[model samples]
Target: MSESRLHLHLHFHFLSLLFLSCVSPSYFSTTNPDDNSYVACGPHQAQVLTEFMNEFDSSHCNLSDPYNGVWCDNSTGAVTMLQLDDCLTGTLNPNSRLFMLHHLRYLDLSHNNFISSSLPSKFGSLNRSYPKRAHW
Candidate 1:
């Protein structure tokens, strides 16, 4: 598929899952960007996130089969986890799209090749911004 169409398709599928996901009563608010939006997560939200993801390099881990490498909270459509371990092989620079997932509570980038690059200082933003109950 064309890059634009592929992105749109990914967004559509992601949104479908988000909307279809079950939400708890305590997390049913749509006014905060920290949480998923009632309308859409927007292109700025999961665009790069999905673009940088693909099928795992190995098919041994079916439990983590999502080719997009993103897991969402559904009710709010906010990304909660990003497991991109051995799935992707690339360098994540300071401006990498991984930083865009502000709501992420669990991020696993282990077991992959970062090309010996250092984690960006900007990644510190995730420290304070991540909501409570963060886990990986």
Candidate 2:
């Protein structure tokens, strides 16, 4: 291969690796159950999550599956990360209990069937201390 082509390929490969690293669920995970210092998710937060789960059809969801991740803050026990991709069906209601999770820093609800649901105004009320990333 030409030198320029080889260099371009290497750059593309590096960028792909970087993107994969950034998107890996384990990179931001804090929910390791075997750790002695692992903090349990707070009752209120857990209840809210349960209510949110109930609002949708979750036949695909494995509540005990670590890949359907939920990470709570070590000190406060507040949910900080949630990843429920492909696990839910049906529209996300406007008054979803999901909006009540004010402590979430990372939330990935991707690949769900929320096409019919409108964006809730309560999205503006969520914790915004972290930078937002909206793909569409």
| lDDT on C-alpha atoms for all candidate structures | 0.43, 0.52
In candidate 1, which residue pairs get closer than 3 Å at backbone N, Cα or C atoms, i.e. clash? 36-76
Q: Which digits, one per residue and each the tens of the lDDT, describe model 1 over residues 1-136?
A: 4433333333332332222122222332222334543433434445544443331122222332232345556456666665444433334457755566677786655445343235558756777766553321
Q: After superposition, how far is residue 60 of candidate 2 from its true place, in Å?
A: 1.3
lDDT of 2 by residue, 1-136 (tens): 4433333322332222122222232332345434635556666776666666656556555534432356778778787766555545555557777777787776666555453435567656554733453211
Report how far off residue 130 is in candidate 2 (Å). 4.6
TM-score for each of the candidates: 0.52, 0.64
In model 1, what lDDT does residue 46 have?
A: 50
Candidate 2 local Cα displacement, residue 40, angstroms: 0.5
Q: What C-alpha lDDT, on a 0 to 100 scale, does residue 98 get in candidate 1?
A: 57
